[model samples]
Target: MGMSVGPSGGGGGRRRGGSRAPMAEINVTPFVDVMLVLLIIFMVTAPLLVAGVPIDLPDSRANALEQEKEPVQISLDAEGQAFIDDAQVSMDDLPAQLEALRKQRGEDNGDAPQVMLRADRSLDYGKVMLVMGELNRAGLNRVSLVTTGSSDRP
Candidate 1:
């Protein structure tokens, strides 16, 4: 003889023949993998970031002078190729180049082009110093070094 059982006290109803319910928890591995992939993509693309050219300038403790206008960026790569505001400027043409650069900034009140020197630390200080001297000779007395502001520094 077949015996009939009793009803279970569990909250939900029991299905005689049906598919089981799926788990509530979400699969996180795919999300994590996607996140990691995104991180890697960003890392790979980070170096491709266009900057105002790279220059390894020396560290200085003195506060930089305030500029009323944006200063021209001069970069000195390790090879000693000098760049004035991203333009390849020869040392001999520095003064004349700066004159034009100053005019480009508008309102040429005979004001010197504010120069910001960015030289590689490995570069010969002679080149950077020579640029400074030439800028001075070109009548650009205002020069500054671009650095991470202490406030913005990590």
Candidate 2:
């Protein structure tokens, strides 16, 4: 029988540095694929990550204002159900809940706590104003209405 020689010119023998050169080239296709998948997942989930209750916010041409501190989030759904942050509370208890929250944040004696109110687009104007009145009577004077940016410019 005759022996065959490999590319290294060895007679069925292993090369000094081994068969493969430790794979000098890196496979970037998988890396790129994983990165693209992660990007798509983030894009799909980023909108759902917003805190507080979900509601159809009305479009507004008014410019958004910046705040110095984290404001209290109050939401009113289409059914007029009130929520302080994510916890549901009746309209009657809204003031007390806000007071408890203010006391916990050490804002009872300090600067007033800012309030961000999100009301559904389908909610009645009078209902929204009623909640605003409640907030005012609770000593939370600084309030900002949260609305989506309108595509049309005034």
Candidate 3:
């Protein structure tokens, strides 16, 4: 309740004039919770800020790729379905489709487009290599494998 300019105690007590107000003491658990949630969101999305589309990369002992721009990532899911960027591309149509994408990417003027393959750990190497061959044939020689960082616990 706000105090009015009057005797508050209902007696002969006078109100203090322009005295400094008492500091408020309040619980801070909600503030801490909100801060923690923001921290979690930042951590979860930080890695995704990197180049290219997001993919669940397979773990490997090989060294990581160091580049400024994200490559055109290709994913081979558990069922061996092929995805260029985020869109599914049939195996038979991959070379022609990639050629079209390369042209659209201004490879005729700008730097050549690239391909990066992310295969399921259980997937056969032959299929991945076959896709590599197709990418090579399509003149996308910058093809490489995507993998989780060695320091990553997952």
Candidate 4:
């Protein structure tokens, strides 16, 4: 009888040389799963990112303006109550408050700070015009009216 000796014991022991090397390839299944979960979370929350006072905007067929800076938002509810950046303020205090805000914004380029007016769809035209006049008087000449886009029907 001949006896053979090797690195592994030859007495009914399992061979180890045929074993596979530790897997060097990255497992992307968990990574892909985490990415998909993050994508779903962002998709679910994207619409809720636009924060502002809720009011029904009038429909218009106007081109949207290109925004350069954050404009001061002024909202008027259906009851004619005024709000500046979601904070309620009396009509009498609006101009001074707006002027202070403009000064704080450092409007020194000969261009007035832009103000976005968001009035309820049911608000009276006169009330809107009056607010416009107030904004103009506050030295905020670059006033833009915010409205929802609508398609014209024949």
Tell me, by TM-score, which candidate is best: 4
Q: Could you say which candidate leads in lDDT?
A: 2
| lDDT (tens digit, per residue) of candidate 2 on 2-117 | 65687766585777667664668888999999999999999999998997687999889888898787888999999999999899999888879877876676464676688999
Tens digit of lDDT per residue, candidate 4, span 52-117? 677889888888999988888899999898999879989989888888877887457767778899
TM-score of each: 0.55, 0.71, 0.60, 0.77
Candidate ordering by TM-score (highest first): 4, 2, 3, 1
Q: List the residue pairs that clash in candidate 1.
A: 56-119
Q: Give the residue spans of candidate 3 off by over 4 A.
A: 1-58, 106-110, 151-154
Residue ranges of candidate 2 with Cα displaced over 4 Å = 1-26, 106-109, 151-154
CA error at residue 32 for candidate 3, angstroms: 9.6
Q: After superposition, how far is residue 11 of candidate 4 from its true place, in Å?
A: 29
Candidate 3's error at 115, in angstroms? 1.8
lDDT tens string, model 3, 1-154?
A: 7445555544434546644566698879999999999999999999987645444666667786677665787888767788888888898888898788767764555656767778877778888888888877777777788788674554
Residue 83 lDDT in candidate 2: 94
Measured over all alpha carbons after superposition, the RMSD of each candidate to the real structure, in angstroms, is 9.4, 6.8, 8.1, 5.8
**Candidate number with the higher lDDT (3 or 4):** 4
Residue pairs of candidate 2 with colliding backbone atoms: none
> How far is 151's C-alpha from truth in model 2 (Å)?
5.9
